[model samples]
Target: MSALDAKKIAEAEALMGQVDSAPDEYAKAGMYFKAATAYRLAKSSDKSKDCFLKAIDCYENNKSWFHAAKSYEQIILLAKENGTLSEVEEYANRACSLYQQHGSPEAAAAALDKAAKMTESKHPELALEFYKRALAVVLIGDATHQASEFASKVSRILVKLKRYEEASKALKKEISLNLQTKSYGQVGRLVVALVLVQLAYGDLADAKKTFKKWGNRCEHQEVSTLQKLLQAFDDGDQELAAKVLASPFIRHMDVEYALLSKNISMPQCIQNGI
Candidate 1:
């Protein structure tokens, strides 16, 4: 390292020594936090993470939950920058829980949402759990927009995981929230999505039941086309199903239609051994 770098590292080490010898909980927490910043300036990421965590522990011991949450949030950001996704998830969740304990449900939900997004690409199941936590926190705070958004996210993840039943359940929660908020537009979309989930699971009866319950509220052309698609699947008419799947209305449903169309086509592909 250069002379200036060495000098900075030594200064950081000295600050860390003071942290270790601090006489009281508050002072120790402050010192550890300062040392963590010093370690970052010295380009020692591992040491920075360690000192931050030590500060978090001290804050927690002293019932300084807000400070602890901030420390965990910093760790999460550092882990993200370092591309340590597992650490990012861990510290984000910790930050979320601490924010919750500190009586900040909005902050908790935001933290959990960040954790969910971080894990979604690499660990969908874990991401689902984080989204659920976020949903719960937002629901508690009556943050309608966040609650609806997180519920939709959870349903999408569950569907991607091929947990169609759970996906339907999550969609139902989203639908309920939309209904409460009188978000008629979103409710219509979620109803279509629910039907798609049911169809993907081969729950034709439930799909029809769901359609009967909520399809009436949707646009006439869209509802009629989806019904025809469902009917084609029920009749095992591959040509008709294919035609219905290709319709502009179904195409507009995007991923939901893709999932249902794929499921409906799978049996025919297997039978024809193609």
Candidate 2:
């Protein structure tokens, strides 16, 4: 090794040793972190990671959640670069927990959301999981408006994945969330989404029950359209059902819902042979 390389590595070793005799947790953490940076500069990546972990431990010993999370963020970037998916997931989760413990739920949620959007196109299912975690983090605080935003995001992704049952459940919960926040105007739209999801999943009975429970909040046009659509299905009037679903109101609701409506093939009728 060159003289400078040897000197850098020796400095790292000395710094790491100093942490053991440090008088305080913060001092120990600083020493370990300095050793980690030196090791990284010397191209000893594994040793750098080890020193980072020790620094994180010292930070945690002092209840320094933000510093611990910052260290984890370094590990997360390394894991991502190495294509160590499981490690990436683990470190990301730890970082989020630490950020939350530091009373930064928005940061926790934004981190997950950023990861989700980055992966949404190629790894949609994983993206969906990330978004769900983000939603949970957002819910940890008193941001009901933020909750509504994430609820819409989660349900839209669910609809795109054609997970109608999960979409229905998400929409139902969102409706309740909106009602609790006195966002009464949103309830009708969410109820429509829930009922549409139930119908798409061939759970007509649940659709009727949902409409009956929340139909009073719907605008007149929505009420008439949904009533006609449900009746068309019950009567096995496939053409009328298609017409109602293809109308501009349904088509322009949202891109996900538009696609979902297009996939709503003619409902099937079960005839009883008496």
Q: Write the per-residue lDDT of candidate 2 for residues 9-89, one digit (tens) a residue.
A: 999999977777899998999898888878766767788889889999999999999889888877665555555545656
Quick one: best TM-score, which candidate?
Answer: 1
RMSD (Å) per prediction:
3.4, 4.4
- For each candidate in turn, the TM-score is 0.86, 0.76
| Model 2 C-alpha RMSD to native | 4.4
Q: Per-residue CA lDDT of candidate 1, range 68-162, in tens?
A: 99998878777777788877767877898899899999889888887788778888988899899899889889899779999989998888888
lDDT of 1 at 182: 84
lDDT of each: 0.80, 0.81
Check candidate 1 and list the clashing pairs.
none
Candidate 1 matches the true fold with a TM-score of 0.86
What's the number of clashes in each of the models?
0, 0
